[model samples]
Target: MAPNKVDIRPGVSVLAVLRHLNYKPWFALAEFVDNAVQSYARHQEALRAHHGDEFKLVVNIDIDTAAPARISIRDNAAGIALEDFGRAFRPAAIPPDRSGLAEFGMGMKSAACWFAPQWSVRTSAFGEDVARTVRFEIENIVNDEIEELDIHEELEDVNHHYTEIILEDIFQVPVGRTVGKLKEHLTDIYRVFIREGTLELRFGGDALTPQEPPVLTAPYFREKDQPARLWRKDVSFDFGDGLSVHGFAALRETANTAKAGFSLFRRGRVIEGSGDEGYRPAAIFGSSNSFRYQRLFGELHLDGFEVSHTKDGFRWDENEQPFLELLREHLDSEELPLLKQAEGYRARPARAQLANTATQAVNNTARAMEDNLPSALPDIADAPPVDAPDEELPHAGTLARKEFNIRFRDKDWHISIELTEDPAESQWLVFSDVAASIERPRRLDIRVSMIHPFMVRFAQTDSEDVEALLRVAAALALAEVIARESGVRHAGTIRRNVNDIVRSALSEA
Candidate 1:
């Protein structure tokens, strides 16, 4: 056959504008992969018959980063047939079948032009003896306002079926950290197909494999006495508007704020939450710092959802909130109650984890406080006397209390600290008796209310921050005891002054 011409005439303007499209590197690369996947899917029966049942579709994407950078995506699949040549090359020529991933024919042209100054496609259809090649010089075509692209042809084996897209002088190249991220996004997007063993997608000669997020398995937080159960729960909901979701909701085996939350899928490919940007809506995941937001995870396939042209997001059509509400209801229940379980469950840290946390906290708090303690003790010891009331301590809402000993000023000092969450507790800092006993060490126990207004406003929610604050409180409590021991009559005055500073100044924040 003579060299053929594919008239992309009407799309002259559209082709020039495509280069400016806001395409993330992964999504742009996905356009080519989508076409390859659709081709394999469409001709699966014929392809298997020709190449034997053991055959599986494999797509290799290679990036040449050395000077004069180039990108090539080669797929062993049912390549473009001679009859579909015009529709395949022409811009905006929608395929007769919109059910497949290649519904938008513009994906190839736009992605190719967006990637480089020049790109080419070479393919030989499964049952044909002729292989075709089409080179697109984007800069020359746009500058000259060319309407047609010449398709080159060559004789090939009748059974050969493959497509190779080579892009040269590429402007958009994945480099450094972006190369790793690109592989991750691509793996996540095609996870379903990869899991089914139908697709072998590779980048830089290495096959991309899906890494399944491990689900939590343990007794419910409130039902600690019960036998451990797998936390993964199957969820299915219908919106009654042709749209439906079917998937499994579960908590991660371990909390990972970066990897938590839902992955939304459409037609077996993830549209949202591919890679680290898992879909974390407040309606389902709660506040970002909530346990659910850090441990919860799932794969929800939206069967009838419409995706953006870029195939990056779903077009919910104002039903996103409603969709989220339905999703939340499914994930929450009196039986398992995924949301509640996720929020309430606290994994008992391993011995190493507990020790590591304690060690880190001690190192951080003591380092900073050691600098100020010497100067503070002198002032506390010289304080004037004020009558301090001795009131009965209330241990009603005590959540937890820990007792430890520290050697300070040649005396073994026993420290007892209590944490309380009760709203009724009026005292933000409750001081207990510091028994000066000849039988044992000088023991001073103090209580701190966590739900106090001052704590809620001034205190940070992190454990490290809370630990630092408590260390400061403990240091002050110890200082007052030492001042009283040193015969400072107004040692109680220091407590009153410190309370006023915390309440009047710090709480205002």
Candidate 2:
């Protein structure tokens, strides 16, 4: 028989496909954040945390609907060389000498195309006072069209030791409203850069600081002002049908009450944990991650896990399945149960400490009010015992911000409340801050960042109608009742101490 001939279809360009796909806004931001991270990592050889003493990333966002919207990200890192322009935007163009964060070259330009049709990058290298600029028009690239004149070139007139990316005519609207979130995302995603002191983030007048501090605290920290961590020896051994888990079951105490926890890592880089996602079941002390509760810090040396250079550094397999099932199973079967039991034991000390502190606080507050009250006011003895709710109280609001304190056993909890008027937004905020003398000895730090619409109403001035005062009073009273039931003292108690405060605050003349 004659040899059979086969025809093949051309594969789609990765850039072309990425350009059309609507990736999540954060994922797109991740690319720019990664660029900032890599730039600093490359320049700062010591692997210092980002946002340290001097180097930085600045993101400027302007949202004027009528005017053109623009999102610009600028970083103080090693800028691209003019000679490397051709290969910079090409796929899988990993520079031979590239290491640190920019191993894969597709990040810079591809990330822009995820949200905008046109974007521009401007850069300047060390010692060289001049900057170089490049413009990548995704619209042009998608159509497979190229023009000879529109190529990368050096801008000798420009001066700086920095790099910048400007995404013009944003195709994604969320980018405009999420500048705050973008700052947070970058702060967390590039925490290593920050701890190394090689990267900084500037928003408005404040240098963005992550809620969590540097991961390393010892030799590496003193050596290079870098955050270095001692690898954990904890591991899980799976044999036959069951799994055995071993790790530090105690929370490491830190003078800094800031949160820390076990973070997910891919290719030796962290993915999630802290306040973003995942849990550190061991870190019941001051951190937010549940995984850290078990101090489950160690290596999971699984081979052939697909870690793409352009990805957000999430763990994945070639088949696109999340590669954490086995890990999760191990944790659930072994680590979690033990962690829970350990937490119960740890809670005893926390509870006793809280009770002693709470009693003292109540006594102090009572003494302070002793001379300020009217004769008719009841004595501290007659005052109701600190009534705190055993269960968390739910709240919803908009346009108004409220806070209260609760007495829990031996602790004082500070609770903050905020409500939003938007109907489509989340409707409630509820969280607790334990008053631990060693950690949160002073005041409980509670926050409700998001507010619900149902609880939202327009702000009113003193001149409002009688009905308005009544409504406000009722709200305050309800809030007070909820606080009492929760054993939490309302931080805003003084403001709403008298009925007149509510009336005056809500009434509109």
Candidate 3:
């Protein structure tokens, strides 16, 4: 048993692995930027000792789409040493410095191979007079014909301390449209780093700026003077082992478009969210499309948490469960009430819009009629006499007024409008339910015929204005019924004339 020695054989093809890397171009490019930033952070003391405190780290990325596409990323950080070249180019190598952003050493090699078939790196370590250069070709590695890494050493400027990666024969290049998207991705991922001025990243000739989270207002109770408002709360939670989360939650006054949810960030980079249902907690937001949850959004930073190899999401383990539970508790106890208050804030504008539209429609119709009318028409004072009032007028006791409850702006109101489902030959019918009334205060039954042509057409479209118009029409019908029951003279004639005018105006609109 002691004599048996088994040798391990590497059977994986480098090009085959590269083909299955599954990296978005933008995320792949971020690898190099991460490396550059980490390099600066790890060697900050050494860099300051060599140069002054004024020494700055700058990363520049240039992309060219002409002919065989090419991309180059250059950084003014402490460059790689001659001794570190072997580990630097090796795939799946663990980094020596793990405190910084670059933990796994696969970022550079994986990103380069994923971006292009041919890539090269040139670096001059700080205080070193010679620079080392290495070139990697996918075709050569795939064939397994290359045993030794070819590295060249050349004399460089005494003050030069930087690393530059150039990708040639690029399989695909980011162009006009994707360039902006790439910039946005990079900025969002490194917003904290950029905002703190720890790193300067330039894409093409433009410098990248941090994307600030939307400002959240504090939620306030709706009062007569200040009816609507938004509110924010600071949230912090600790899950032991130096792992903690801190951020702010905001309950907004209006519906959120895309900026609603907890944006989870780790190590100054956004891992998830700043979107709808980015982090789901049923107790806090209920479910997706819940009105209360839609108005809430925030950003939370995870101080110490394990991330996936791709760095796109967090590793949900036993330790993460407590953090999520704490977050849920905070939302339920503190944020839920603010969300309820925000409901009133959201409704005020919708109600105002409906009222304004109805008022404008009536005014427009009246103006059009006035402009078309002949100026020579006889006045109401000279009009023919009307018929005598009906002797058998309906009594007020014959009509019943029922109370209907409506919820608006987080408050309920009672009104005497009865709803019915019975089909009528006409579009709508408003009548007093005296026979059906047994209570002291009777309510008029305003029956809307769903089978009528007007109701059928409006129901199919489901427009907001259609609903508003229906409410207005029901109110007018109720007014007419009340006047008739009270025995108001000429009430029947007035109701007929108003109905005809409304019908004509609606046709014109």
Candidate 4:
């Protein structure tokens, strides 16, 4: 008997246009995995019985990079049934059921065409006696306006169920760094299924596994003596009209800026937020550098949300704001105040400590300071009378800039210091500050002048002398800000005295 034809005429030309669809490599690969998972779910019982009691759905993706590169993905699931073959191959044809991860029938076709000009799908459905293979030569089909494709079939065991898709002469094959990152994102996207024991996804000969971090369990920073409590909390909220969320929000036992933020899921797959690109809403996380952003992480399952065709993001339709408002209300409740805890908790970083040589250097400096303190300190450190008027700061042509942050007395401090070579500015140290409140971090901006007469005479040619002078200037600027914060009036007195005394008595010129 002659096999039935697959009509792919008018819509077949659309394959050329799909290649330009903005698709990240990881998201594009996920399309095949979604189809495999959906198929496994649709015929779980019968397929499980045929395989074994310990049967688990597995999907493997291989990327061949040598010479003529090719990509292949194979899955152990109920393949395209004979009845559904037409709709499956047709462009933009909706599936019979639109509730699963493969709801948008465009995933396979779009992704396949986006990846290569030629591809083939070979599959044997769960109960079907005949196995079939369908191949697409997109360029020939489009250029020649070909309307029909041959379906090659062969008799097969009725219980065998699997699908294999091979993309030949790959257009954009993943290579080098992309291979590792591709595995990471693919693992993250299917982490929920991996957790639930529903799917075992593999890529490049390795099974992808989830790497869940440990949650924090410590007393709040303010309540040091109190007993420790785990910082993981379950959150559930409804924004009315079928929009809802359920998940757990937590702080990592150790802070990791890159791995933090919410992973929004739908239909047992990540719709938004995977890998380092977690969904961090500014309303809740503030700046990306904020402690909340470095510590807070979660897995949120969204029940009543519409996902994009690519399944990479949700379609909010002006509902995102209200959804966030409710999410914040539920996650940041007064009783459990998650944002406060994330900000209040401080963990020391794990970067390399000072070496023995550095410690010895510090000890030598301290000893020298101890020996010189009595005579030098009394003359320079004595509290000077408040005489200099508070004056406006002068601007400069900045030559270098750097910044560092310090956590002290349970407050965040940002130090933005700069070096300036502008000869028009006579002052050695110029500073400005923004005071910290409950609402904002404290900021101190300092510019040390390198073209002052005293600096030019004493430290212009020696890098070591220039370093010492910069340290002194920065220390003096910091002391001024701290003294003003401590309610000392005319905080500029010490700087004014030092500037004048150095220029008059110590100036080599």
Candidate 5:
């Protein structure tokens, strides 16, 4: 049979070809940064033999949105040869094998097209004073149709020894929105490359600087002769004394939250943090024993996989998912016993303790007295002290006394407070823990019931004085609870729940 021939389309612009890529908005920047890093590495290797540290390969991004209206990426690299600049412009083309860091020659065209309709690149290398340039505009060549981009002639520049990709007529993209988004998405995506000092990213004057690796590293428990100890905690329980399970949990606190979540890292770099495919569903929650108490962090070392040319990212192909799942299952086995122990601990009743119950009672009385006094009322002359007889005052109401006993280690205390009501008075109930050990002291504890207070306060059948008294008492009790609880520092979750409870009561009334 004769050799088969197929007609090929001509004049397909690079933009038309790049549009076919599954280029999401977030991935576009990664592609561009990858190309920049490749250029930097090329520059570094060429100069490494010369043994001069004059100018390390770097990528500088200038974000100027004024009338000049441009963004530029300049790199001092073994730029494209004067001839290759034009050839580089076409779609589906790969760079020569000698290009160290750049692979998949399509990244340049695809990444540039995603950002703007018009973009150009200039390059220079090896004692060449003038660099070659290639310019292509997607909109002009595509004629507003979604088609491949065609490359124009590669022009040589005069006196410029480096490459600068200038993006113009940027399709009216929002700079603020773009920069803020790029900051978050690209930060972790490029973390490892940045850390290795193999790449640099600058946005105007702001830069994402890299940090040194940790001084201490944690073991995955699978390693032999562990270099340093990875901290682990064991938890067990005696629930009804019959059943028990043993589990353990460990954490290297620093690395876990360094990226804002319990990232499952492999080979000292992040794999799970950047890609969802690398994480097992079970790993979504930390170790079962640590759901509420701690976050589980995993670090694995895999040095053999091929990382993408961007240098900031990589993949393990089909092996990643199963690998993560196995790790998660292992962590669960180690955490079950601890989770059981924690569950038992949380099931127990919570207790509060305080010294000087008598003083607290007296303070409560004094606070009540100050609160009840009206601003217009003049001070009574030589008023009877607290010890004075309970003589009948002009006020017509029944006083309600509520008393409670709170117990803690080694002491006993009593607390009583008076509530005045013009209608049905408040009731009191008292219970004593006579068997309470000296190791457990019962102190006076009082809590005003909010549900009943609001119910009676707003009753339609109540007299004006009765309603006013109930309202005052409810408001006073609420004020006291707020003052005491707010003064102490504690978890906001409980406080928020309490506030919702009070609000519900008030709404019902």
Candidate 6:
């Protein structure tokens, strides 16, 4: 009988698949770091034997922005052995055991392909005498030109053990800003490893540092009359199946949006929080008043929850629900009343910080104007009175622009002023209505055009006192006219007249 013949049809294009892998530049780069850290952990015994317990696991990321850009991640870890070359580069091969951070076995290849069209790895296993190399080209693979990975071997010292992944013709070169963002993301994601001193990660020669979450000790009540009492609780519970969760919840004396929310960690690495979801319980964050629990923040380590493939979030399976429900129960019974009391103690009508700052600034500017313009302005108080023409004094109606009796419907009007670099040729000042008005108060924002030739000339003076006075005068003058004529049909005419007066006064001063 003839040997059976089999044929398999290709399902997808390799490059196309990689192009849609959905890896952000930073997250893709993280995959390599993840592999290096895991390798270091797996070979801790060998590394210690060779370099002593003082040995530090280091991963360095270097990027070249020249034409045909390149990126390389080098790690001082137990490198790949010659025999494992096939598994390392294969698309879907799994490791012999599920240990360390190397799971699914696709991170390395997927990350490499996502970063560049061609890449190579140079690695030498611990105690090995030869270093192995494997190069991959997506173009070659997609075209079906390369049947197998071409491995190269080089003689090396037995003690040398390291792996360096070099990506050539990088799809995108990370500029300085992009690198900085990457450093921040990686620092947070791998904070646990960095904090424990198990791994030292560096980019452009600077080591990444971990950021610790702030701890809250008291309930945050903005009202000064009510003194705050710090409240905190330790939470620990089991979900059966050898799974458990443990952490602490605290209410602060001041509500901090930045520090609010639950930070969930898995295996010492933060997978969520600082704004990524999953730890919000209705009992804590579910009040009709969003800020009722904004003062609440905490961390919870899910002992048995599985993270998504991207490692950016949790799976949210049935196993995780028990812990969340238990947390909600505790918060509803123990913490809700304290939060409500803190809310009640808060001052009902609080003045905004910006308004207070603006008021203080205006006062200081008025004093400065008095000092600088004491002689600039004519002494009207001491001027001789001029005789009025005996032509019958015009009736009040003829002398006054119609008084509309405009009243602001809102109890408070928030006015903010800012300087912008608009061209001198443009309007000297502009006004815009600020959307998202603060509660109980309407806000109006004004921008003083700094690029106006008049402003530019004043700005070049020896001191900013003159410019500050001019800006404040213009803003106040304009605001006075707008507010006085708010309901008048001809308010635009009044605004123009006010602008002319302000411009003449500023120019003469």
| Clashes within 3 Å, all models in order | 3, 64, 11, 0, 16, 10
Q: Estimate, for each residue in 98-157, the C-alpha lDDT of model 3 and write its tens digit.
A: 776788767887888888888999999987998878787778766774545567778998
lDDT of 4 by residue, 1-509 (tens): 13567765457778889899888888989999999999999889887787777788999999999857899999989999877887888888888798888887799999998898899999999888888999999889889877778899999888778899999898877899889889989999999899888888888889999999999998866677998888888989887888888999988887666899999999889988888898999998998667788889999999989988888899999989988898788777876778888876655332121122222333343344334434442432222222223554566565556666654534565666666667777777777776665776666676766566676554443344555776677668757755765568878889888888776776632
Residues 358-409 of candidate 5 have per-residue lDDT tens digits of 2343345435534453332233212221121111222223233445442222
Candidate 1 wrong stretches, greater than 4 Å: 1-3, 349-364, 370-378, 381-509
TM-score of each: 0.78, 0.47, 0.64, 0.72, 0.49, 0.62
lDDT scores in order: 0.78, 0.44, 0.61, 0.78, 0.44, 0.60
Compose the digit string of candidate 2's lDDT tens values, residues 110-180: 67777677788777875565666667665565466442214344545334567778888877555355766
Instruction: Give the 10-residue window scoring lowest on summed lDDT in candidate 3.
Output: 1-10
Candidate 4's TM-score: 0.72
Candidate topping TM-score: 1
How many pairs of residues in model 5 come into backbone collision? 16
Worst 10 residues of 4 by lDDT: 350-359
Task: Give the winner by TM-score: 2 or 5.
Answer: 5
lDDT (Cα, 0-100) at 380 in candidate 1: 37
- For candidate 1, the clash count comes to 3
After superposition, the stretches of candidate 4 with alpha carbons farther than 4 Å from their true spots are 1-4, 351-473, 477-509
Clashes of 2: 64
Q: Give the TM-score of candidate 5.
A: 0.49
Query: For residue 255, what is the lDDT in candidate 4?
Result: 68
Candidate 1 local lDDT, 257-367, one digit each (tens) = 888978899888888998888999998888877778988999999988888888888898898998988888888877778998887676643434433444454445554
Per-residue error for 493 in candidate 4, Å, reads: 11
> lDDT of candidate 4?
0.78
Model 1, position 163: C-alpha lDDT score: 95
